[model samples]
Target: MANDRRMTTDRFFGGVGERLENLQALFKFVDTTEPDKAELQDWLESNTAAKSESTIKAYVGFQRSVGLLELEKDQYQTTPRGATFADTGDPELIFEALLENVDGFETILQTLDNEQTTTTAIQASLREAYPEYQLPQAVVGRHLEWLQAIDAIEKQQSADRYELTSFGKRLLQEKLDQKPTIDDLEIGSTYDRVELHEAYGGARYRGIAPSADYPYVFLFTGDSGTEHGYKDEFRGDTFIYTGEGRTGDMEMTGGNKAIRDHKEDSCELHLFENNDEAWSVTYLGQFECVDWFEEQLPDTDGDHRKAIRFKLEPVANEVEFTDPDLGAVDTDELYERATGAARTDDEATQQTTVETTRTIYSRSEAVREYALRVADGVCQGCGDEAPFLGNDGEPYFEVHHLYRRSDGGPDHPDNVIALCPNCHRRVHHGKDGDAFNQELISRAENVESDSGK
Candidate 1:
């Protein structure tokens, strides 16, 4: 390890119970008055819980070291993070500052990722992380207190043990993950909180983040809507996104307005989908709002309300390419995803978001690969060998869904059959296509049952 390293250390002001509120209080006080050291001590005695001069002195120095406070000439002033926390009382803004300016604060939370740890263990980590500093037990305790105050961590049932709360784990994931480079923002790439916001500047929360600094509006949608009883879905190629606001009729304001006016504002609308990864979302490429409509939906309070659902169309049609490496593709993993992606009309989970398009694409691709692998160049429908070999030197055969693709059927293995082009077009365009397709559906079902689905 390199000996040259930056150290971020905070002193235990007052006691081990030093917390975010104390810093918030100091920030509030300094917004109005440019107080000198004695004046600050007197103000702290009157306005804060700290009355001792020693504790007050420690508070000033600690705040200064953490970039929360600045000593200009002789008076104190709050930095941007400090000022923002003072005005909004939003802990995460302050948490961002702690991430940059306090050691052990983030280290302790990371150490407790899946398990609990003690103050002694945290102190040891701080000692290792910042060898130049004297990180005592009190320093670790104070860091733990701040984390607790911000609801990022909690004390375990055991008196000495501590662990990250759910919020803590998520916060750590977002703050610690590496920001994606420009090339990494592909159509299906996942990002920590944001890849676009950092690249172009926008709100980091809510469904929409309109950048005042740039001509861009970012829209996020997903199955996460299921959590809040809101619905977002993909109706064919159009993504139906429910506007923001959990309760009451959603008005044309904030994120909703930004998305609505994206075209007139000349701001590009970039779409992303919520994924399973904590503090992360998958980029779904750019979309333009073609239309919007109001519908009756339950709010967070479960009350019926009128909400706007925007119909967004992709700016450019996505071309699906057959993977040249399909021979080496993991069929088992693709099978699981394909089978799990059945189209659901469930009101609760109509929130398929981009899954219907993305997952269906996966589902069909997997089934085609699967059926071809099973057929050994023979057509399931016609019971004939393939007419020719493909460009890849593999026998050419097509996978046909029993239910037509236009009907929005799932591409599960049990519902698809390997067919030669003659049989494929016959089922689609022949006068006896319906009966032939029905017979093939039964044949496909039996085939999948006999082998694999």
Candidate 2:
């Protein structure tokens, strides 16, 4: 929550360059101005880059909103944060105040978390989140400019896209108790850099994140990497992925070793295409490293080094569906296996196709099947029988995760519940999703607990 002062004040600002230099001019005006409320606008426009009185007023409001400027007896004054920045010449203090005091500052950062976005995308997101503000196009652009001005986000030189900076990531993690809000990751799916790190760790700045905690070694490659000649592309049936190492020789160590020996370690290889246009990556399906060879490549430091590039072939892991074979396993055995079982990804079983493979994990399968079986042709949420029969001639139910898969929630019996379509929508899209989810949570706990007995 913003302070009462910030909550009531207007945050929209206009006119002037959305750069740090413009802001510094304002601080100078404040230092030189006399304590006169009536002459403040004149002083601002004349002393600063703002040419219009309205822009000057807007700047004042913006500064006040961020705790940079204060109104003392109707005269313009600087706050402690403002005074400190003015004295020390540090822009971090200004950005800190913006993140801490502004209503939509942090929201904008989170919106950019997964990938870089256009000014238009940022505007659309702001409208969706804070429609009441109804900020104009220019106001929104100014806000983004402020973010870039403070180094929280960087504008791509070639395009209008804005990418989050390392400093911005650090601020989000350290200042705000923020993490990825992604609920689940469907195979053949796409995720942003931020969500990738949240799901498996080890993927933000590197080409290959070891992802030892998960069942796969995640490979990230994008058009950006092509700049350094660390290009990852496809050749016939093989997806060629270059080894990781910025400087010196690219050795078969760390993430490179992880990728080379994934098969020996019982780890799968998951390939994602990092989008050049946006900040997200698309899963191209799972791959198997059939071969690897050393190649001479120029490192970031401009040294010719030996790099290990891997030959990846599409993995066609087979998964057996249980719908046809339902009830073949005894209830006791089903409960035993399904209890606390987990999976590599969110999908309950692998998709049957040899291309663009999706996971239908056996463990997640157990979680889904156990929930559906225990429901006994009933809707878990409403205590009513399923709405209709599926193509398999059984009650139809969609499994809902009490905790999200992207948040590292397990695909175990305790974390999922089966619900009818109507009940499922109510849990996810209804007016009170959390409240409705709470109802299902209780029912799921009861269902899992009763089966244990």
Give per-residue CA lDDT, model 2, range 1-453, as digits (tens).
112213222323332234456566566667677345557777556655557767667757777777888888877787878777767767688777865555466667877887988888887776544433565777677667667666788889899898889977876666445433223545446677675665544445567765422455678777678567595754323567998877777777767888888889777777777665465877676778878998888877677878788988666422333434545656655665666334445344453333352333344455567778767887878889988899989888988777643234445567777889898878767899889887777766775588675
Judging by lDDT against the true structure, name the best candidate: 1
Residues 288-352 of candidate 1 have per-residue lDDT tens digits of: 88789999999888989998999887674332323345556566654554455433478327654
Each candidate's number of clashing pairs is 0, 7
- lDDT score, residue 343, model 1? 38
Model 1 stretches astray by more than 4 angstroms: 1-18, 124-134, 179-453
Please give the RMSD to the true structure for each candidate, in Å: 21.0, 19.1
Q: Estimate each model's TM-score.
A: 0.37, 0.37
For residue 257, give model 1's deviation from the true position in Å: 56
List per-prediction Cα lDDT, in the order shown. 0.69, 0.66
Candidate 1 TM-score to native: 0.37
